[model samples]
Target: MGHVIVGVDEGPEAPTLIAVAAEMAQRHGAPLSAVTVGRDGAEQDGAPWLPDLLLRIREKHPQLQCAGFTLTGTPADEITEAASGARLLVIGSRGLSGISGIVRGSVSQAILEGTSSPVLVVPSRTTSDKHRASG
Candidate 1:
């Protein structure tokens, strides 16, 4: 069975992306793979967090099969390659404004363009939402 693959980063939205992916995997009875990519020679904050994230997912869904991968390469390219033939690819959107998103470029957009797998993008919580959640 094709697995559900999730692109993970050490961003505030990572948990949301992971949770959505896990739920999809559970519903489909597919294994879950969490992947974080770093540029060659550059340190990635997400690299160190991948294992812990997988552990938490496993604990939360004890019957789910979960795996994590830390890779070095371009984020879009690596994620696309990893998601090849996957049942689904889950990613997070930072919810940047259109112009800002164009200026910054979006890994989710690039992956969407490059990969054949279906993608689910979880939107990031806005600043006010964060504050409200904390409040």
Candidate 2:
């Protein structure tokens, strides 16, 4: 009922994940917090991109509340920490998990296992090639 958090990396932005997440957030009337994980040197030019992304999301859904957080930490740690009071957490399956996810480790799986919040692992149904082709 509160907000849905989407974890992402700096490069390789996934449109499917963002589109799906934005849709869900709009549907549920919940705030979409797009969290991009980074290491120590994350702050750049006073975090210009964060405000830009926020502007886009806010424009798309005037009724929806949205924000972005550029976190300086491991993906799992940053995302898990942010998911503390979230109603739901959304992330791409290929993020840190692949086919052998049930056994091996992934940031999504780790956060899923560790956090009490529900995590929605949106599969990379649309491949990179397809995205590039379409774009």
Candidate 3:
């Protein structure tokens, strides 16, 4: 089996999604990789966080095999390419909306449409909690 690849950002939900990916990886007995994609000049700037995040995760789940990667390119393309041979891909949904609250974050949508691997899009905790409180 292949590793579980997770696309993450600096958003609040990133750690949550990573935790989910780690659990999935443990369940599958596979490795976990977390990737962050940034623009040209800002590419390397965002690279450091994933390694630190992975460290924290490892501290909690010592037996889990995990790694981190940072890439420069369009988020969707980078994530799709990185997840090509992955068993599963996980991402946090920013749930950006248009004028009428229509979901407008195309990166996640594009990945969902383009990737051959299974994609798990998780909602931000604040968003989920808001929905739960409302309902």
Candidate 1 regions with alpha-carbon error over 4 angstroms? 43-46, 127-135
The list of candidate 2 runs beyond 4 A from truth reads 11-13, 41-53, 95-105, 126-135
- Summarize candidate 2's per-residue lDDT along 5-117 as a digit string, tens digits: 88865444555556567778898878888887767666644345566666767777788778777777777888888988887788886633356665566776777877878
Cα RMSD for candidates in order: 3.3, 4.7, 2.1
Candidate 3 lDDT over 34-123, as tens digits, reads: 998888676276566677789988998899999988889889999999999899999877666686345444788889999999988888
For model 1, state the Cα shift of residue 65 in Å. Answer: 0.7
Candidates by lDDT, descending order: 1, 3, 2
For each candidate in turn, the TM-score is: 0.87, 0.73, 0.88
TM for candidate 3 is 0.88
Candidate number with the higher lDDT (2 or 3)? 3
Write model 1 residue lDDT over 77-98, tens digit each, in one string.
Answer: 9999999999999998776657
Error of 3 at 71 (Å): 0.2
